[model samples]
Target: MWELQEVPGRSKILIHTANYSADVQGCIGIGSNLAPGGWWVTQSRKAMQQLRELLPPEFDLTITHYVPEYP
Candidate 1:
């Protein structure tokens, strides 16, 4: 998940996705693979749960939008 600070109330906006785009409006997608149409995420819940456990309650999350290449 990603977050942006410096806003008015300093609220922590989450960047997570549900099963379909219709379920979440303009929200970021999370999963191991893109769905068939490439508009949805395949394993969003699993990905989110894993992320949630790893993150601390209050902390800064920097989003670089970087994708690592594998050998």
Candidate 2:
């Protein structure tokens, strides 16, 4: 498990594998794609394994939130 650092007013935030959004609590979940209706993620274990192999032991991360425009 990887803990996030320098998050304001938050502690113990980790990046881990979770099959669904409901499986996580205030932490980042790793997955390959979003399930139908975007309620949760899929292929979490595979994604996590790929991440483990691709990423270094420690590194900097940046997260950005994007909202889709619907007509």
Candidate 3:
């Protein structure tokens, strides 16, 4: 697992996958799309696989918070 460094008051944070957010614990979950109501993410395994192919073994990740405006 890739460990996040320099996060305040946090350690061992990783980028992982799960079918539902309920299955995740204090870690980043990677998914391709949101489920019908946006409660959970879908295609997590596929997304992870794609990330594995695209990302280098070691690289820096930037996390950004984005909220879509829905009319």
Candidate 4:
């Protein structure tokens, strides 16, 4: 499973497991799956590792929703 951590900055965002956009909840989710349900991914840890490697020592992440919200 992917772990979500809060990064301090303009906003506190999450870094976690999400294969599809629907799985996201104001937090980031990374997974191999291109579809929805359970945020299931083949290699979750490896994906997280790759992300860590690609980013700088310290970085800020922002997550935005593609869908519209209704109150």
| Candidate achieving the largest TM-score | 2
TM-score quality measure for candidate 3: 0.82
* Model 1 spans > 4 angstroms off: 1-12, 64-71
Off by over 4 Å in 3: none
lDDT of 1 at 38: 64
Tens digit of per-residue lDDT, candidate 2, span 1-71: 68899988999899999977677899999999889887788998999899999999899999888899999
Kindly list the per-residue Cα lDDT of model 4 for residues 11-68, writing each as its tens digit.
Answer: 5455665555566666567654444445355555567778777877665555565986
Worst 10 residues of 4 by lDDT: 1-10
**How close is each model in CA RMSD to the real structure?**
5.0, 1.5, 1.6, 6.7
Clashing pairs in 3: none
Global lDDT scores for all candidate models: 0.68, 0.89, 0.84, 0.58
- By TM-score rank, best first, the candidates go 2, 3, 1, 4
Location of the lowest summed lDDT over 10 successive residues in candidate 1: 5-14
Compare candidates 1 and 4 on TM-score and give the better one. Answer: 1
Task: Record all residue pairs in model 1 with backbone atoms less than 3 Å apart, i.e. clashing.
Answer: none
Off by over 4 Å in 2: none
Q: Residue-wise lDDT of candidate 1 within 1-71, one digit each (tens)?
A: 56556655646555775777776565466676677856666888798888778877667655566887969
Question: TM per model?
Answer: 0.53, 0.86, 0.82, 0.44
